[model samples]
Target: METKQTDIKLKTPIRCIVKLGGAAITCKNEFEKINEANLITVSSQLREAMMFGSSSGSVLEMDWSKRPGMAESLVKVDDYKEQLVLDFSSFVVIHGAGSFGHFQASTSGVHRGGLNQPLVKAGFVATRISVTSLNLEIVRALAREGIPSVAMSPFSCGWSTRERNIASADVSAVVEALDSGFVPVLHGDAVLDEALGCTILSGDVIISHLAAHLKPQFVVFLTDVFGVYDRPPAEPNAVLLREIAVREDGSWSVVNPTLEDSDKQVEISVASHDTTGGMVTKISEAAMIAKHGIDVYIVKAATEHSLTALSGKLRDKIPDDWLGTVIRHVS
Candidate 1:
């Protein structure tokens, strides 16, 4: 009997998991409206970021070219690359619902989950339509940038929860997709709940869960503001927190913003129309993920710093001049 080696991931050493914040890509104040400029800009940046990656611990590239139906004229080559054009496969993109589903979810009380209510059930359907529509648009944007990507919604992917907390979820398909040279794009969705019938699963929670499972070298959050702030980003006294450290106990503290920055506070507020827990929930979830030794960086989308982050250049020490927030676990 002869044994042949056949185990190789599409791209080993996944560099980063990137999350596109709802506020960064959509018009939060306008219902169901997408910020086209932001979406296209980020999509281009992603194309650049994913163009270069190591050829896996083993070989990970399968290159071929054809001219429309000229089967006999096709050309194929295995470049034997130590560095190759396969990094995009290492990226897993997840996004949130800004003005898309939030209005419907909040108005219909979808996240509250009452299967008994006619309105709640109807809201569940409406909410998914909104978010999934956004998902499709995002996929299209990436495709336009020459990215091979697909939309994988939690609802359709066997994701369910118990009392709004993720209970039984599956990532097998995600792993399969990544290993096949395709970028799997996921989003916050409305999912079934054993206790609540159906509820909203925010992108914040989804990204944190992905971080735990995928164990990327780092996580990047593309946001509308500079980074995590002491208060709502629009507030007059808001101050960006450059660094945060998670303790072993799962609690976190500001590693930057010294005593003189006391004027800035840490109080967070949920938006009036948001069914999800807003920035407060984002910080809490980020802290939880950071406790596991994975660092998370939050930066403004479409800026030079964001381009650097998307390119995986901020994996280690973030530049002192870059305006972003980093969450790391500290012993």
Candidate 2:
């Protein structure tokens, strides 16, 4: 018997996982209302990218449950998905629950609250309903854009934990979609489980999972700030880490250290307990994926040139300290 090699050619057009941070879609400042103008601007850029075929697919991950009148937001996402499909004819999308599940999980102190809480049943119900509503908005949005987009829930897709398992399923779906020439839109949502009960999946986790499985040329994490700042941006001389090297200990080291005596080392930290993953989780996850030889870019979504930067078309146009971090394998 002859042994045959499995020749699975990587899909074309460059498969990428574009993470739209919740903070980018929500309030930049406490006093400011939702940034509708910025939202529209970003959406237009995405539309243009799809129109010209710069991006193979896109995913919008936000926490809609926390927002007021979430039903309305869902409508917006659906409308956008629809428009994109009609206009561009190809593209994948994913969104997160803005605030729907965040509040409940936070208050209950149950990282996976909805599964077994009878007292907080009302909250759980509301969260699920709100997520569904938000999904509708994404669908409608794709319709309006003439792009065919689909909404997926954790429960529906068999996501029950915050570990690599969730990432596995998500990546499987994305790969399936790409192989069949369909765009898969995923979002952060509450998933029901009999084993761990119920848990809220974070968008960052989803992105990390995709990168690990797909091993794309690069992964792009878009946020409100220009990129990761050297200081907190409030202080003077706050610089950005242009490139990060993954260490054997699974930590990221910047070229420049913040203090003279201190090592130029930093670990991505989780944002909150309610959220499944955070910056730290993302960095760690990206580092793991990089070990297999992948590059990750953390950039500011607010920058109009973000898409161009990721596409490697405007390399000379971006500044040195653009407010983001790049993680790559040293070896």
Q: Model 2, stretches more than 4 Å misplaced?
A: 1-14, 28-34, 51-96, 110-114, 162-172, 193-195, 235-237, 256-274, 314-323
Give the per-residue lDDT of model 1 (tens digit) for 203-316. Answer: 989888777777788888998988888877788977789988888998778878764544334787777998888888888888888987988888999888898887767666
Report residue 164 deviation for candidate 1 (angstroms). Answer: 0.6
Give TM per candidate: 0.85, 0.71
lDDT of each: 0.82, 0.55
lDDT assessment of candidate 2? 0.55
Off by over 4 Å in 1: 1-11, 53-89, 260-265
lDDT per residue as tens, model 2, 133-234:
656655544444444456666657666563224522534555566666555667776665445555566677666665655555666676666666555544
| TM-score, structure 2 vs. true | 0.71
- How many clashes does each candidate structure show, in the order listed? 0, 62
Top of the candidates by TM-score: 1
Q: Which pairs in model 1 have colliding backbones?
A: none
Poorest lDDT segment (10 consecutive residues) of candidate 1: 1-10
